[model samples]
Target: MPSEIAPAGLRERKKEETRRLLLEGAAHLFKERGFEGTTVADIAAYANVSVRTFFRYFESKEALLLPDGVEIFAYVEHALSERPADEAPLDAVCNALLAAAKPFSASTLTALSHPLEDIENVITARLVQAFSDFEERLTVLVQRRLPPDTPDADLKAAVIACAALSAVRAVLRTRRARRASGISDTGPAPLLRAFGILHEIGSPERP
Candidate 1:
């Protein structure tokens, strides 16, 4: 049975590899020629796969061009659980997101191309919809971390969760704008700057 299952596993791996290839190819094409200039056939040809094979991987070219961010969310869930109990609620949310972003940070910055357009209305909409459920789950966890005496704990949790999401979007948007303008690299400066902003956002006003 193990021997029989090995072939199936190998086939699945091959499919994933092809899918990744298509995604990479699509990203390059979208950056090079813009979204409207690129097509399903262009991505298929670039990835050395047939149009039918491309359909097997992604229903549309736009889907291939945009990242799903599933891995980042998975990392966030794990990071949140492992964060020190004494960590502040805002810090935990912010740090968990940045920590989760670490592995993909380089690729994410490198691929920061043309994120401003509404050419694909469903692009941001789709990603936002997917994140809503995870945000709710994180909000519950964050609320539990706060003291019981904290007033309006639900509102506090929702605020922190929303702020964290906004901070992430802001950082990526900055990088996209930088990339779109032919910036060579974003470096760790954006990360540091973003950290300071996120770290300070919900804090009490300084004297």
Candidate 2:
């Protein structure tokens, strides 16, 4: 007789396969038809799956493009928890931002190299959505990390989060401007400038 398989294990495996297929299909469709034009049914058809299966993995098309940001935020929170007690809150946040940006920056560069129209509706929109999701998460994470007696921890955290996001958007916008200007080698200057601005804002007692 064949061994009985666990229903939960099978369900999880099926979910993973469905997720992979949906993402792959969505990427292709977004590249081919532009993100705004690609419908859920189109993605489902491209993946050879039902429309319901597509919704099981992603709530909206914008999700497929930036699925990792939430996961990255969890990793960042974990990393922050391991920081030295003597480290300033801003310093800890800066470190986390740098680490988080490494992977995200690389992916954004790859996306930026693609046609502007392809990314405008798909990649950029997804990034904005991800940042919106991250803001609340970051606020909570910062509150937890700060001392219980700290005043206005949530507000300060919100400011820091906004500053960090602003930095990221500025960097990407600079890259877009460079491309628009027909300058091929804008180099790391734009990214460096973004970091500088973020650091200034994130520093304790911002000057």
Candidate 3:
């Protein structure tokens, strides 16, 4: 049993390593050459793998930026579920977005942003569809946390989820702009600030 399992485990590890290499290679090339300038062959050569191997891991060059959604959705769900029961729905969602972002490094986030900025064709359409799915899922999750008798419960959930997601989008756009300006930003400070502005928008005016 151990012998059989060992080979299987080793194969899985190799597959994961190859996947990582492809992702890293794609990122590096995308950064250096821009998304439209970088081809699958380029990425494959960067990773020292055949182009066929690249196709085995990803459908196209665009896919390197657009990862599978299942894992991220699960992470967001778990983070949302773990938020304090007493927290406001929007606050919980914002915190969960922050938590969901914790796993990505600055370079990874920047790489993801490249496709977002450069390719306004297939990738853009796919991103819009993906965000719509996320928005719908977040609304359902937020609604689950609300009081059963809450007024306009569905409307409220959709608003809260959309607002939280907008905050994240705002942060990513800022990061992308800053990167283009040769400035660097890291950590969640910008994201927190975006949420702070969101909260302020909902508050009464102060002197």
Clashes of 3: 0
Put down candidate 3 lDDT per residue, 1-43, tens digits, no spaces: 8999999999999998989898788767766877788899998
In candidate 3, which residue ranges exceed 4 Å CA deviation? 1-16, 24-56, 59-62, 68-70
Q: Number of the top candidate by TM-score?
A: 3
Candidate 1 lDDT trough over 10 residues, lowest sum: 109-118
Better lDDT candidate (1, 3): 3
What stretches of model 2 exceed 4 Å from their correct place? 1-28, 31-37, 44-62, 108-129, 182-193, 201-207
- C-alpha RMSD by candidate, in order: 4.7, 6.2, 3.9
* TM-score winner, 1 or 2: 1
Report the CA-based lDDT of candidate 2 relative to the real structure.
0.68
* Candidate with more favorable, higher TM-score: 2 or 3: 3
Q: Which ranges of candidate 1 are over 4 A from the true structure?
A: 1-17, 25-66, 105-118, 185-189, 204-207
Task: In model 3, state the lDDT of residue 159.
Answer: 96
Ranking by lDDT: 3, 1, 2
Q: What value of lDDT does candidate 3 attain over all alpha carbons?
A: 0.81
* Residue pairs with backbone overlap in model 3: none
Best by lDDT: 3
